[model samples]
Target: MAKTLLRSVGLFGAGMIAATLAPAIGAVDVGTYKELDQFMSVFERVRADYVDKVDDRTLIKGAIDGMLASLDPHSAYLDARDRQNMRTQTQGSYGGLGLSVTMEDGAVKIMTSQEDTPAAKAGLKTGDYITHLDGKLLYGGSLDEAVDQMRGKPGTRISLTVVRPGRDKPFDVSLTREVIQLKPVKWEVKNEVGIININTFVNSNTGDSVRAAIAGVQKSLGHDPLGYVIDLRSNPGGLLDQAIDVADIFLDRGEIVSQRGREKGDIERRYATATPTDLAHGLPIIVLVDAGSASAAEIVAGALQDQKRALVMGERSFGKGSVQTVLELSDDTALKLTTARYYTPSGRSVQEGGIKPDIIVPQLSDADYKARPRLREADLRRHLINEAKVDDKILEDDGKPDPRFQLTADGLKKQGIDDFQLDYAIKTIARMSQPPLRTALAGAKRGAK
Candidate 1:
């Protein structure tokens, strides 16, 4: 029945009523009008006989919230305040301490402070849990409410009390809100290898930043980098168009990604159309990912891997292949609904199952594990289920280990295999300057074409 309703809604263009339902019905078999009449009758009775007066607006808002909440977790009803915040987030400017936060075990925890922002300058750590704001209790409150309390006009002051893991008591930090413009790319040249840290995929100048990073490497090394290491650790992705643009920077020509909806003939494919500006064409490219790397991050990882353009290192990505379409409501609120599921060039789904790294390298330490910082996993409270019934040997190959690449981890030392992954990539790049690996990759490319 729900599937039928969804199909009907899909046909009518989500949340819009059917043309046949626009007219008042004398009788209906499904009791749709009768249920609404019953609800209205109860509402009228409550207005007439309730112990106190109730605002109609409050009731209507509650109904809307309840309705949206009944959908999937990603589908949400955003009020005007939330809509404004969404705009602020997408525009990459917000008046606040400039910290990403998540709710964990009923407490608001700092995810990561934006670089050069008030939170970073004031010494807020990633693992700190916010216990109070402006001396008001914050735990057990909605994340939205906590965000509202933290945000204000530029130059306004706000105080936060945080519980650091190793600290004894909660510490108070006061900061003045300022407009935060996030820079997505940070880079450095190390041992003739270009290492670029992509914090997010949202900045308007990400492509320019990447190009500049490559140029910086070229200037430092007196030539283009022998190899490139892209660090995407702890990067929750943003902006699909930016992801497409970033992928285009590396590929000469190929399909980057594609989206397929339930409707027939709704498939859309995005392809690379430009040549790379960097001179590191055949250089050994290694991408670093972790559990925090998600969405657009997965798209880039999957696309590059499908084309065999780069070797992926670290853990599997956070699977979030669904695409959301934001719809404006009549009351100035909004709805961010998951309307489509995207697929990689190889036709892989990243919804519940994320992209498997070409080389698996555990990046977390015992200290990181014990810290118990709030992450998307904790926020979503995800539980892994057995999917063997679907494909018993999805990662297996011919009863033998697949040799597409080697997977290694540094273990819990935090300085071992995981740290060594990037070093190894750099070494591989250095060897690529004179190696059989470079010859093999070149041969593979020739074979592919």
Candidate 2:
């Protein structure tokens, strides 16, 4: 069954993945031969007459990258460096500045640095833009290229010029590379509620870690506890199966998510009733997502919300519902292909317009909430389109203020309210646990400015 998985994957319009010699096999016809000849003609001309000397490998890699990139933003050619990086990811360790980054406006923008990592220790914040590496100007290279430069042997020091938001000047921060062992699940019992923060889905055993955390919280509390709050804010996604496992941990039954390929009627569904998957033990749960939440993170959030297993809160999530399947090539390289799109159990596709929470909660304590321009799958160049009817503009904020969110960031800061979203979730959980809190919250809501 494991061996036939690849063959079965082809049925979902990933037929090209299994075709190893498709170019040669399909070039039997005269027209196909002519097309192949045309490709070679351009390739030879660039190699022979280009002003700068170009190697066969460089030209071939460029051609491969272009071909895959043309398909979608998520698809790309992974060179040897990229393949090695993928291997490092599976090992759950990398010697680097320990920052998750993306290319935005010709700069390498930091997306939430992992805690206790070099990036976080060095005072890196989300939304800081790295304009240069070690004094050399960096004007937009691929995200992989920028990350490769930041990674080196342990103890190696590198400097980055960071342009922070609301700052007048860009500053340089020196950081030493270190081997980062990511702990995907961390839980703490706050006010008798389990606050589980799944930072990333990098590890295959993330679900197990979460289960252990939940158990530990229950053990420490010496009680069933009120509920759990799964915080998925600023969590850019990782492994797909980990997401599935995490979602299943909360869902007792029903379909979790489905992936449909380019071919019509070609889809695969993942269900949660397979093996007693509900690990929360039928407890009340709330999921918190922000504009930075995406991909695998969105998967778990959407599943729980669709199954009515958890209440989703916060702003619309960053829609990145496409699946990237890495196909290895003969040359120690690979192709990160976007084979299919993500769909909720309700058959709803939040491709560009991400999952809307049951209750929209804003980050009142974060002053930059109004100005923070977060990236979405829709913002990506050449992102895969959702065939389902979707209004991309629906994800945009109307610039209208909600009366319930009348509290100012400055006022919250004065009151030492660091995180309004978390505070709201805890209050909501407390209300759920004690009915009297609901009356208090209701009166406060009515009196809210």
Cα displacement (angstroms), candidate 1, residue 98, comes to: 3.1
Q: For residues 182-228, could you state the per-residue lDDT of candidate 1 as single tens digits?
A: 77888888787899888787555666777777778788888777789
User: All models: lDDT?
Assistant: 0.69, 0.79
> What would the per-residue lDDT of candidate 2 be over residues 116-189, giving only the tens digit for each residue?
78998887877789999999888857777788789889999999998877778889999999998877888898
Q: What TM-score number comes out for model 1?
A: 0.75
Off by over 4 Å in 1: 1-29, 38-54, 103-106, 109-129, 152-179, 274-280, 330-332, 364-366, 370-428, 431-434, 445-449
In model 2, which residue pairs have backbone atoms overlapping below 3 Å? none
Give the Å error, residue 93, model 1. Answer: 2.8
Task: Name the lDDT of candidate 1.
Answer: 0.69
In terms of TM-score, the best-performing candidate is 2
